[model samples]
Target chain A: MSKEYVLKEVEFWDGAMASSQALRQAEVDIMAAYPITPSTPIIQNYADYLSNGYVDGEYIRTESEHAAMSACVAASAAGARVTTATSSQGFALMIEVLYQASGMRLPVVLNVANRALAAPLNVNGDHSDLYLGRDAGWINLCTFNQQEVYDMTLMSFKIGEHKNVRLPVMVHQDGFICSHTAQNVAPLQDDVARKFVGDFEAVDSLLDFARPVTYGAQTEEDWHFEHKAKQHKAIMDSINVIEDTFEEFEKLTGRKYNAVESYMMEDAEIAIVALGTTIESSIEAARQLREEGIKVGIVAPRVFRPFPYDKIADALKNVKAIGILDRSSPGGALGMLFNEVTAAIYTNDTKPVINNYIYGLGGRDTTIADLKQIAKEIQANADAGKLTTPVQQFSGLRGPKLSFFDMESSK
Target chain B: MLEIRWHSRAGQGAVTGAKGLGDIVSDTGKQVQAFAFYGSAKRGAAMSAYNRIDDKPILNHEKFMIPDYVLVLDPALAFIGNITANEKEDTKYIITTHLSKKELLEKLPNLDEKRVYTLDCMKISQETIGRAIPNTPMLGALMKVSGMFEIDYFKNAIIKVLSKFPQKIVDANLKAIQRAYEEVV
Candidate 1:
């Protein structure tokens, strides 16, 4: 029977309920976290669960994210399903041990609400935090909406706990987009989530008292390389497990998802590739452009670790030029999404000129009008043969236009 | 398609009103969509909820550049921003104010004079329900302006949502919905 989960709709939430419902489905046995912007509610929600008897879990309010990950590592190694969440510099603080959680073969799932790292501070949605942990050995995935956050949080546990892929996973949601924006989400029923995830077996094969042995052994130089080599192989094998897990999740719940979902890409001439909330807005833009007899579509990249290179390349074969809409600047380099598009193109003939767009820095809004502006720029760049080696231009931002209005006049 | 642009700050329950309106009108077997464009991404910031009630499925998800009807739950918003941006010659503006339509329009002369219908929704909210969540109350004023449903239909529609609360609160809210339907001029 189909049931409607009547969540408080879009603007009413403080993100506490999203975190609460996810924690319930995760059935988290251990929670160790420090509070940070846009992600404080995850801990607050878990805390409420503990006090109200909504869930039976030991919630550990740690001093820092580093300590939190360390506690999660310990709990998972000792046969407990663990979850810890963080954002901004707090998420960046876990980069050191996050790698170890994978190499040590622990299945700790984390909720990373994406926010910008500091120089000038930002407290809103962006992917800089998630990008900083790209090589930390955890399987990283991004979500666009609150529904995806709830669904992906539960799916992360299943994906991590798969025996063949005993690695940690990070389910990244744009801070305010999914976290703060409330929506009606169909949460996983306890019986179904428990049945699917099953019982978690601790990684230590010698966990049995009868055959106790040392774990995390200090090895000679020769064994160190081989051990790390196996960890790399397991992380790579997660690609297959991710697909299988989705299949199982679909059977349990009637929702279908993918590593890379292509929208209206059949014989598309121009494609805008991006991730997170912008993709939803971009899809609407693409549909509108299609109505006007323009051949356009969106390549929404969901998984970031493996990057779904082959899948994206195969789909974009018919398309000509592609625009990479990145929310963050790569400084002297091109935007992050632009580089990924180039890498995905196997051949130069099939490779479209990828225009790198670094738009909406410091949590600026990316409206549908802004999306149309990007499309116009992409078309112009394509026409002028201007996309040469990933040039980053100043993008659409609201303030006094600096073209004629100098900042000194204001002071 | 009759598009209504709902103006409210975050946590003020305009989104709930949008969904409730969608549910109530959908019983008439009309196609409807309810969504919002949020801002500041916080507990309290200016936000806009939207509804497109039509005989066909709504394809446009963007905020309406020109809305057919405007519902303002906050009276103070009149001073802060242009709450009536998309008002056509025939568009109706149902605003929650402490004053009558003429007095409020005299204060906010920027608003269109031809089709503005201002009611004291806060008084309706306070007197009928004993609280100041003006979403249901403004819906009463909207019912008067748009002439879509009877007061009883909206009362039943509100009952579906308010049933989740305690009986006393739910009954009060139902009474508020009913009174707003009759009382709003």
Candidate 2:
């Protein structure tokens, strides 16, 4: 499309330390980050930003993730906008303060580069990070690529800082896919981005320094439930704020994205579902099937935290079967996303036999062939009218096909 | 609508090239979507990405299974990933390799003729930037094949995108892109 923009090619792995330089272009005023596998860049980036006068706010090098988020609370509470990033373990560590920030109604934004939390010592992309913290009362949004990471980071400030949604928001990007992959992102012009975002000042309240009153007063259990109600109200009320933020972002960027994006499933019998980076490959598979008149579609989830049920179910209602693709290991259960899709689709009247496809685990590569195979299998299974367990596993090439651990650990 | 699929490994600059191409095309008033299909593969793993430009809003966000244009960043991966099968009947194959376009076509006996446009960005990259990264140089070849965007426009776009980097690196990249843009037929 002949529109006015610049493009260039860049490398993905410039070392973890190089990542912060990318974010520094945003002119981040305040940042708090703690080290975690693959996600160390968030903190590393902020550290580099600190040494130079690259950003204006306090760069807190906290000892722990809990402290990192606590510092963000302190900074954001004092009326200076703040940013912090974390991964699986770090995300788990920051969980407590996550509730604290949301409950206090601080408009702090956190970028979650999702990774697997493990006894296996994994440092790859997975949903475990975001899923573990799903109920923590934060706006969770996933970006499929590095460009979206930058765009979402810029957009989050506007969304979180919005007057209507004074709750915290978590912008989630895949750990290695977007965080590590170097691509030719058209980093927004700083002045233009700032102008589009406008200036952010703390919503003045009675707690203004001139007036002098403390917020987040300890609530007694007798009325603590009611105090929690206000926070819940903010979470529910944020849907509108999130929508308005996206509307404004679309206006500024001329690129539109929704909480859920659908591709060519209309009048189709089977649907292949996914989110983030996996959408690209799945669409290719869908195109192949389309040419064969196999009739397939895809629904990529954009917002997993609020769990956009209405959007997902309404989109898939016409389909006869849906294949759910998840990038993370569900362990004994199923892929985290597959479980969520099933929960969303379980109640429909004209029900489709949804086949949950678990794949791309341990940071493995999922290709169009893998997706195409799953699409065909799911279609056949649905046509035969016999599918069970809500998940049809499509595993990649097992180097040795042996279960190495094999109950030896139990002994 | 021009649907181009770029095949490269995860750490390669294919996705960036895709986005840059989309950015350049947008300058010509077309709607475009630049996205990558990545696996859990680490940095050295093979990956496929894409760029689509059209006169209208693109509803087909899926990778162009039948791509009008195919950019093979690492020629070796053309076989490993079976990228050859994704090529359409009359698709343009702009590959980065040491072999000439004719030589490259002969190498892939199963692949068709006429649509083939092979380039050795490896040679061009070494001559210009002194590095093996042929992303910008291959981008020049893509510009030549498509006529979707001008070489000068892409050169300007490269300077703007890489302007944030050091002057030496910026100039090297500019030279690499310029050489490919001008030399590729």
The most accurate candidate by lDDT is 1
Kindly list the per-residue Cα lDDT of model 1 for residues A1-411, writing each as its tens digit: 112233332322323356557666567788888898778788888777677776678888787899999989888877789998899899888888897788788889988888887877778777788778888888987776666777677778888988899889998877765565443455566666667767666666444676675656787896989988888888878889998888888887877888887888886778888878778778777777777766778887777875778887876787667787777757667666777877887554564655667776656767677787677666655555445333545557556432221224222
- What ranges in model 1 sit over 4 Å off? A1-22, A46-50, A184-188, A205-208, A211-224, A346-349, A381-390, A399-411, B1-69, B85-91, B143-165
lDDT of 1 at A200: 63
Which candidate tops TM-score?
A: 1
Instruction: List ranges where model 2 is wrong by over 4 Å.
Output: A1-28, A35-55, A182-192, A203-207, A213-220, A388-394, A397-411, B1-185
lDDT of 2 by residue, B5-80 (tens): 8888776688777766665665555666666765446886788777766776443433335788888888787556
Pairs in steric clash, model 1: none
Rate residue B20 of model 2 by lDDT. Answer: 62
Report fnat, model 2.
0.03
For residues B1-185, could you state the per-residue lDDT of candidate 1 as single tens digits? Answer: 78888888777788888877876776666766666664345656778887777775433334445688888888887668577776778777777788877788788787745577777777877887788888887887787767798777777766866776888887877777777777666
List of chain A TM-scores, every candidate: 0.89, 0.86
What value does DockQ give for candidate 1?
0.20
Provide DockQ values for all models, in the order shown. 0.20, 0.09
